[model samples]
Target: MNSKKLLLYSSVFAIQGLSNAVIPILPELAGEGSTSPAVSSLLYSGYFIGALLTLLPFGILADRIGNLKVVSLGITLTLISGIFISISDNLWVLGISRFVEGLGCGAFFPAAYSMIADWKDSHQSLGEFNFLLNAGLAAGVFFSGMLAELEIKTAINIFTLLAFLSFIFLLRETRGQTPDNSGRKKDEYGTSKRVKPPGEPHENRTGFKPGMYLEKTRETFFENGFWKLWGISVVLYGATGVLNSNYADYSAGFLTKPELGFAISASYLAAMLSSLAAGKTKAKNKSIIRAGIVLAAAGILFSLKVPLLAFFLIGAGGGAAVLGLVAAVSRVSSSGIAMGLFNTGIYAGLGLIPVFGSLFIGPLGYESVFLGSGLVLLTTLFVKFE
Candidate 1:
């Protein structure tokens, strides 16, 4: 409901955009430095690992400290990491910088989402908010790819500058919204209002016990069907990551390198378009989830043909499918923990499964990875909706 919150959300989303922009270009950059594909893939994987580790803690911290502080800290880290990467000549140093960057970027989503959850009026509007987030990311990735063609280092330079700008804007914009209990005032009823600090022990007056995060956890899991929906989301996100991390590499062998870049850009364009549409769609959760799964499965299946046109179509389909999934996930939960868990599964799947895929892919080939990821999605398709 707050314009300032929305603006801050936009900045957090732009961080995602900047990260996505750099992802597709990593392979080429690694190749330029004579790093192997596996090592190059690690550049991406390391960031996810960093993200996976930090998501929960960051979410908890955001709930306690306030989203703006956490987000500002994260952006500072991102900017520093980018500067580190810009100067590094060795792959290992670059990888370390990326891992640290991921920790910062990883926290941004849940922190920002938590803020949005705290601010928004209707719960359903999260789908639209997420659409905006994804749009920022889509545009970020698109620009990253477009910028990389000029020089990968230069692209990083631009992103680093953007990060600084974001930090400044966020500092100015969120000045009054800090979650620190010290600055807040209480109402006349002695209710001790103003959303209690996330880490503080609320008195028994609130009808919930202290030291019972586990109780809320249990309620969300078994009682609320959180696990069922979360399981499906994990699989979908993993599959999407597989597509994202590899699209440029696979297509490069067929198309000119620049065309491969264009294809990757096109995939994000598809995502950007779909996210925009998702912002407008009135579809129910059931229909959207089903459609997303089907589209994703179909995209993976179509990608097996290995034709240039098929690649483009599959990317577009997968993008649309994921847009649907984002809409679906945003509908279910508002907590940063929920967002963090959802993201953890997705990134974990993306980060870890590829290890297995790499092993089998060498023997069974690229098509197997596509089929296998699709089969995983197909299994999820039959899962009973929560």
Candidate 2:
């Protein structure tokens, strides 16, 4: 409810809203005479590709420079990319722009989560963040579908405008703020108190060594049951990624564009609600994760037959699972690096898993891909969180 949290949440909502605004209209964006399904897929996945490459580096940079600075830079990139997407009709151009836009997200998330990791009630804060994240996605899908009826590029233009506003607000809010270097500690009341700035001569300052980066990454990945958390992210996100990528086209056979958007939006809405619920719950993180896995698997298995219910289940499950995973990872040392690694797993799943599934769609069919993804989610039940 503080100004900082409000700014972070609002900025996330705008950027994420733009990210999925194009999904329902992927075919139109791909253009006529483009028979290749790959073009449409590229239009959708390019954002994730950009984010996948930059998340970790930005996390490291956030640790050095400042989180708010990276967040500001990310909003700037998103604004630029939104303009590019709005003006360009070329498929390749749009693809590249989407990639750049994703880079903006890659920059934002690790830094933002790093900031959140400094909070007193990180679990509840993360839940609230995730809730807004899903709300943005749902709004993007629903409004894009509604707006595209007026004009194909109308939704893109509108989201770009929102991004512009968010960027301006971010600049005003973060002006004159410097990076905190007290190493992620909080007072008894959960408010952060700054130590000597990073520029001060301190024994702990190693000045961005490559060996230290690798060492911290290795230690973070192996410690505190984080690998299990990372695996859960991969499976859960990968399953949803497969759904997000393929389900639109698959469902097109039965549903109209608006209806398709509604179905997808329903999933995100469910996620938003569930995330809010998860944050307030006292259940163990692992238990929540286990329940989430079951619900998601059920959703994926039934997606082909019951589109709305299936997606809703997936969203609900994903929301809870991610809240648990992120809350768990927030406990590790070097919050920036931990968040970087955690998000790297997310983008890897979102960007790469669908590409992996695409290979099987030709030989094994869409059903195989869905079933495989569902089974993959189920397999994670065996992963020990302790």
- Candidate 2 TM-score, C-alpha based: 0.87
lDDT of 2 by residue, 1-386 (tens): 67568778888888989999988888788765424345666777789889999999887777766666788889899999999999999887898999999999988987788777667777678768877888889989888877777888787888899888887777667553443465432112224434544433212556679897899889999997888889889878888787777776667678777887888899898887887788889998888888888988999988989988998999889888887887778765445678788888888888777767766676777788899989988999999875
TM-score of 1: 0.78
User: TM per model?
Assistant: 0.78, 0.87
Residue 217 accuracy (lDDT) in model 1:
53
Minimum summed lDDT over a 10-residue window in model 2 is located at: 184-193
> lDDT score, residue 311, model 1?
40
Which has the greatest TM-score?
2
Q: What's model 1's lDDT at 129?
A: 63
